[model samples]
Target chain A: MTFDWGFVGEAMPDLLTGLRYTVQATVLGYAVALVVGLLVAIVRRGAPPLVAGTVHWVMEFIRCTPLLVQLFFVFYVLPGVGIELSPLTAGVIGLGLHYAAYTAEVYRSGMEGVPRGQWEATRALSLPAHRVWLAVILPQAIRRVIPALGNYLIAMFKDTPLLFAITVPELLFEANQLGGQYFKYLETMTVVGLLFVVVSVPSAIAIRLLERRYAAV
Target chain B: MNFFVDALPLYLNGARYTLLITVGGCALAFAIAMAVGILGSTRSAALRALASVYVEVFRGVAALVLMFWLFYAMPLLTGYRLEPVFAAILALGLNIGAYGAENVRGAIKAVPRSQYEATVALNLSWTQRMRLVVLPQAWAQMLPTFGNLVIELMKGSAVVSLIAVSDITFVAQQLRTFTGETVLAFAAALVTYFVIAQVFVALMRLAERSANRRLGRIPARPRRRAKPAGAAAKGGAA
Candidate 1:
């Protein structure tokens, strides 16, 4: 029941190490999600019907299943297929691919939000496909969905703790280690929970503001 | 194939337990959500502040942290350890309840102002106004978002398997350990989970339809009208 200020001060350095992993994995994983998700959205938009349909079902499958299960499959199962990865690599890939399904939907909806007249203008001007996407459609589309993307980024940040299950030494995992080693979870868990709250609550409010700002646009 | 046949009972039993936890968690979450949401929406600032703190704390941390805090930390602090399944249910209920509160609050607020005016004009009591007018409309508004949160609760219950809860995911892990059949173990669990998601989806749709029917939105038969293409943003993002 006692709050251990001394122990918390001592544990700060190790906790920061865990926080570093959290932020690094979030950045790397979100980068992967953005790129792969865009590719998925593009393929789903313009690929042949059968390919697009198959991709849709695959995306649905990914969306429906739990990320924890997917993480386990990646870390434990993939090794059997001779595709073994270190824990961090597997964690990033699992988090990235899981969110990619979500981001792809965000991107597709954003693209669909682009005005039909803009597509017509590109066609009338005989613009190349890549050029239309790069020069016109993508700019408006990306701007419109930036807030949605930001929300997913925050979500990915929170979920980085699930990496602990795969033995990644992220923040929550560090708290678990500290608690187990010293038998002092009160400080470790409370501090980590506060750290999460401090970071996440403000980011969430910013995203809402962003959404409102874009709604006016 | 023979291995899968041999392991069928393990997967089935695992799925049964998973469903049990999900059901237990959803029921608990629904009760908490209703209480917190109505409390937070009321005129009393003290009640609202308390409810808001619960929602914020639950929503702030990820489910893993909350679960670990309860299962591992709470006992040290309070000398009362939760059984693992109860811990899973409490954590899942609290986590999902936070999101559900937003859904309930938003739905209540979204109810037409005219309805409240009508309640006032009729001199209905507060309880009468809520029971006769506000709640029905708000309840209808709540169904879809509530459905999404229910699916989320089911998915989140998988995390309890990490605490050795023998959930479908745990069964898959155990099968992988015993038989070293990675693909079969995971794929089985994956399919079962997908089915659960679909079940929620279908049930929610049915609930939505019935609510609409009750409220006179549709007469009897359902018709599909193309919505003027806005992105389907399923709520409960946090």
Candidate 2:
């Protein structure tokens, strides 16, 4: 019914610690997404017919399912297959793999958007395929998709809370713990929600700016 | 394998709830999104700001967090016990509505200036201008993005499991807990969601064709393949 500044102040340290884990998971997860997504797009592009088509379907499957379910699958289901992962590792891998499907699409578009002439030019110049990919196509593609990639970073940040299911000590997980400990949701959730707003609002605005800037190009 | 046969009824029930929540939430979200979108697109600065705050707040927080707030916090704060299905629908609707509002605004804005000029030249009233002229064209543009939102909304519906909603995901989780067969239960979930997404995409394509047909134009090449470039990240894109 009323605000509690004192409780908020006392809970600040724990939430900040959780925020740290959230950021770490985000950075690590997004790093995995960046590398994995680019690799997927490149492989899918050059893949043999069956492989490419199967990869496409798999990517679609990953994108369509909920991340919360995926996290549960990774953390719970993988153990049945004789794979065990720590909460943080499972969370990061789950987050990374899910967003990778999206970023892979982004990368696929960026790569395809490159002019046909450039690929032909590389061939004409007798550049090796890897050189063409590494030195030519990817640089341009990556540059074009940087903001798209950055938007994923913010998305991954907001999504880290889903890791709470696996007991990862992310921001919302911390808030949930605090609420359970004290039997109060108003203060803990309000603080955590506000923290999310603090981070996400500006980034959303920035993504809009990036979109406008890229539209001009 | 045998477990799946035994769990068939549960999965079916789950699917029903999942489909119901998605349909209900998306219907409400579409109305809310259009209202907020029109508000954001209006000439009045205050109205635009109000709409902006709603979008930012809802869009910024994850759906799971909002669901928690509504389910756990609301009951505590207001002493008004909210049903899990109601909470799930309200949270998912509000959450997706924020992104949908943004996309709606984009589609409305994408209606060319020439179209507005044509409305003015024809002496159409403001309502006629929006309903007759701007909206039809905008609806065509909005479909592809709406398709994405619908898929995302179904995916987001999985979060209702967190609050014990009897959606497909919740049912899967319950079956998993009871049978201790996590792989089968969750794999079924993944495949079910995939099939739903495919069906949604097919439906959107049909709607797009009809919309274009309304304008007396034959539907041509699918624009969906080209849409992800600019429209990525519009609806949580998660």
Candidate 3:
């Protein structure tokens, strides 16, 4: 019932392994979100009305529902349709796809913040569309939104514990397993919470600095 | 399809629990937000420090981790066991309340300096100044963010299922295992959550309109195409 330092010492190595998976999932999942989110933002803006509207609603639907349920669906249901994914694959996709709906909005805002003069200048020069987007638009837009994107990175880091549900052996999952095995939840769960705080608090401060730097520009 | 029919009552029951947690968590979160947020804006350095510490610590921890700690670890530490549903609500309230506190503090600070001066000139007590002069204006500014937080809390309520609470997600999982109709089970749950979220959105919009009207300001026309710029800053560490 009391807090146990020795038990925490015993749990450290396993919990560290869990922390590694948590970090890995967060990085891999965020990478997917960044690329997929940019594509979603572009298509929503420039594609045909039917395609854009469909994409828009799909993102809205994804945003409204819970990520936990979406994770469950991706992990359990997709296999029925012959798209089997390992737990880590499913967890990464669920995190990426859910956050993509969010990051796409960030991209849209960043793009919208670009001055109309910039778009007009590209048109005046008669640049090809691909060149315009890649050479001019994306760099400016992405630069301004880096801070906002960093915020989501920390948010995703906090969310990595949800991967436990799919048996992903992440930090919280390891803690829960240890707690059940030892009948001592205090040490393991406290360590897990502290680990999250250790990572996220510093990241948040850094993102706020980025926000200030970008806002000045 | 047969599974849907057989599971209708269970789904409804689960949906009821989801609604309960959403409502309960929001009430608790709002109370904490107001208290901590006001404390944060106060002149007292100690109170502000206390508010900052609460916000930072709670916001930094994941809601699931907090929930597990409350449900599993609290009993060992304090020897007082919490009911599963109460533990879920408490953890979620504490987590989301931290974000809400920022919104509340920002909204309060956004009130013009002249208003505080006016209250001072009128010899208003602190409570009168806050209640009569300040909160009415700040309440309007806080609505849009509060709406987002409410939806986040509802989404977060899904984590209660992990602790064996029979919320809609839990029911969906059960139905999936019971009938092997994974898609239908989860799709139903997703749609239920979507409907609840949209309803909350509509309500918040209505509240915002009313709040604006009370301030004698005209309501802006609803846009058809793009969302407002604020939508971009939606996610917090909930």
Q: Which one is best on lDDT?
A: 3
Worst lDDT run of 10 residues, candidate 2 chain B, spans B229-238
lDDT by residue (tens digit), candidate 2, A1-217: 7667788898899999999999999999999998899889988999898999898878878887888889999999777788888899999999999888888988988898799999999999999989999999999888778777778888888889888888999898889988889877888898888899999989878887887787665
Instruction: Give the per-residue Cα lDDT of candidate 1 at B34.
Output: 89
TM-score (C-alpha) between model 2 and the true structure: 0.95
DockQ metric for all predictions? 0.52, 0.58, 0.63
How far in Å is the alpha carbon of B221 misplaced in model 2? 4.0
What's the C-alpha lDDT at position B91 in model 1? 86
What's the CA error at residue A81 for candidate 2, in Å?
2.7
Poorest lDDT segment (10 consecutive residues) of candidate 3 chain A: A201-210
Q: Model 3: runs farther than 4 Å from truth?
A: B223-234
Lowest lDDT 10-residue stretch of candidate 2 chain A:
A208-217
lDDT of 3 at B54: 90
What is the per-residue lDDT of model 1 for residues A1-217, given as tens digits with 9 covering 90 to 100? 7889999999999999999999988999999999989999999998999999899878778877888999998998778889879888899999899888888888887999999999999999999999999999999999999888888888788789889999999898898899889988988998998999999888877888889999866
| Alpha-carbon deviation at B206 in model 2, angstroms | 1.0
**lDDT per residue (tens digit) for residues B1-238 in model 3:** 6877888899899989999999999999999999999999999999999998898888899889999999999899998999999999999899889999988988999999999999999999999999998999999899888888888889989999999999999999898888888899999999999999889888988898899889888857763434422232245542
lDDT at B86 for candidate 2? 83
